[model samples]
Target: MRFVSWNVNGIRACVKKGFLDYFHKVDADIFCIQESKLQEGQIQLELEGYEQYWNYAERKGYSGTAIFTKIKPLSVSYGVGDLDTEAEGRIITLEFESFYFITMYTPNSKRDLARLDERLEWEDAIRTYLLQLEQVKPVILCGDLNVAHQEIDLKNPKSNRGNSGFTVEEREKMTKLLDAGFVDSFRYKYPEKTDAFTWWSYMSKVRERNIGWRIDYFIVSSSLADKIGDAQIHSEVLGSDHCPILLELEQ
Candidate 1:
C-alpha cells in the first residue's frame, strides 16, 4: 500500500500548476493534502477511482484538508474534539478494517509567535486524540504537521531556532507524539540523511537553494514500523511551496 502526503498550499492555485498531472502520475492508493484554502462547492476535482473526503474551515479561503483514497473507509470523522470542529478545517480521520488513517493541518504559530499558545494547546489535544485512536488500532497519520522536530530537519538550524515552527515547545510536542508509539517513517528509514525537506519558503531563491523545512510527515504506529517498505521526499515535484512525501508499506 502506498500513502502520499502534501500540503498543496492552496488546492485551486496548485491545480493550475500541473497538480493533476502529478496526481495522476503518482497514482497513490491514498493521497492526503493540507492547506486546501477553499470552502465547499468552490472547486470540484474529477479523481477517477478515488473516494474524496474534505473538511473546510468555517472561515473562507483558509486552512483546510482533504483525502482521496481508492479504498473506501469503514467510517470517517471530522475533527479531534469540540475545540477544533469550527475553528479551521484541520483534521479528518478514516477508519479502515486494519487501521485508522488521519490527515491533519496543524495550526501554525504566526510569524510573530502570536499563536504559539494556541498551537501548543492544539498539539496537546491532537496527541491525546491520536493516543485514543491507537488504543483501538494502529494509526496512519500524515499532513503538514507544521513543525521541524530537530535541527537536522531544516537549513540554517541555528538561525531558525526559536522561530514559529522550530520553537522548543513545538518540537517537544512532536517528540512526545513519537514517544507515544508513533514513528516518523522517513527518519525511521534514513536516520542520518541531511537536507531532506518537504516545505520551502516562497521567498526569492529560497526554494532554489533548498532552504526548506521537513514539516510534513507520514507517521505510523510503531507497531507498523517493520511493515514500512520505503519513505521518500519528492522535492522535484512542483505546485505548492511544499512537495509530496511518500510512504509505501508491504502487503
Candidate 2:
C-alpha cells in the first residue's frame, strides 16, 4: 500500500499553488493532510476516486486535518476517545480490517511556549491512546507532529534548541512515544539522512538553502516495521511551507 502525508498549511491557499496537480500526480492510496485551516462548506474538492474525510476546527480558518483515500475504511473516528480534542481538528482515526490509520495535527506551543503544558498533555494522551489501539492492531499514524525530534531532524539544531518545535520537552516527548512502540519510519530507513527535511521556514531563501525541519512524519507500530518499504521526503514539491512525505508498505 502507498501512503502520503503533508501539512498543507492552508488547504485553500495550497490548492491555488497546484495542490491538485501534485495530488493527482502522486496517486497515493491514502493521502493525509494537516493544517487545512478551514470550516465546513468553505471549499469543495473534486478528487475523482478519493473519499474525503475532514476534521474541521471549531474556530474558522484554524487548525484542521483531513484524509483522502481511494479505499474506504470500515470505520472512522475523530480525536482520542472522549478526550477534549478536535476542537481544533487535530486528529482523525480510520479503522480498516487490519490496521488503524491515524492522521494527526499536533498543537504547537507557540513562539512564547504559552501552550507548552497543553501540548505535553496532548502527547501523553495520544501516546496512551495509540498504545491501547496497538493492543488490537497495528497503527499507521502520520501528519505534522509539530516537533523536530532530534538534532539531525532540523538544519541548525543548536540554534533552534529552545524553540517551540525543537525544545527539549517536545523532542523528549517524541522520543518517549517512539520508545513506547512506534517506529519513525523515515529515520528507521535512513538514520543518517540529514538533508531530508519536510517543513521549511517561509523566510527569505530558507527553503532555497534547504534550512528545514522534518516535523512531519509517518510513524507506525513496531510490528509494521518489516512492512515498511521506501519512505521519501518530496522536498521539491511546493504549495505550502511543508512538502509531502510518502511511505510504501509491502506485504
Candidate 1: tens digits of C-alpha lDDT, residues 24-87: 9999999999999999999999999999999999899999999999999999999977665556
**Alpha carbon lDDT of residue 152, candidate 2?**
91
Tens digit per residue, CA lDDT, model 2, 1-251: 99999999999999999999999999999999999999989999999999999999999899999999999999999989877786989999999989999999999999999999999999999999999999999999999999999899999999888999999999999999999989999999998988889988889999999998999999999999999998999999999999999999996
lDDT of each: 0.94, 0.94
Q: Which portions of model 2 show Cα errors greater than 4 Å?
A: none
lDDT of 2 at 222: 94
lDDT of 1 at 176: 95
Residue 95 accuracy (lDDT) in model 2:
94
The 10-residue segment with the lowest total lDDT in model 2: 79-88
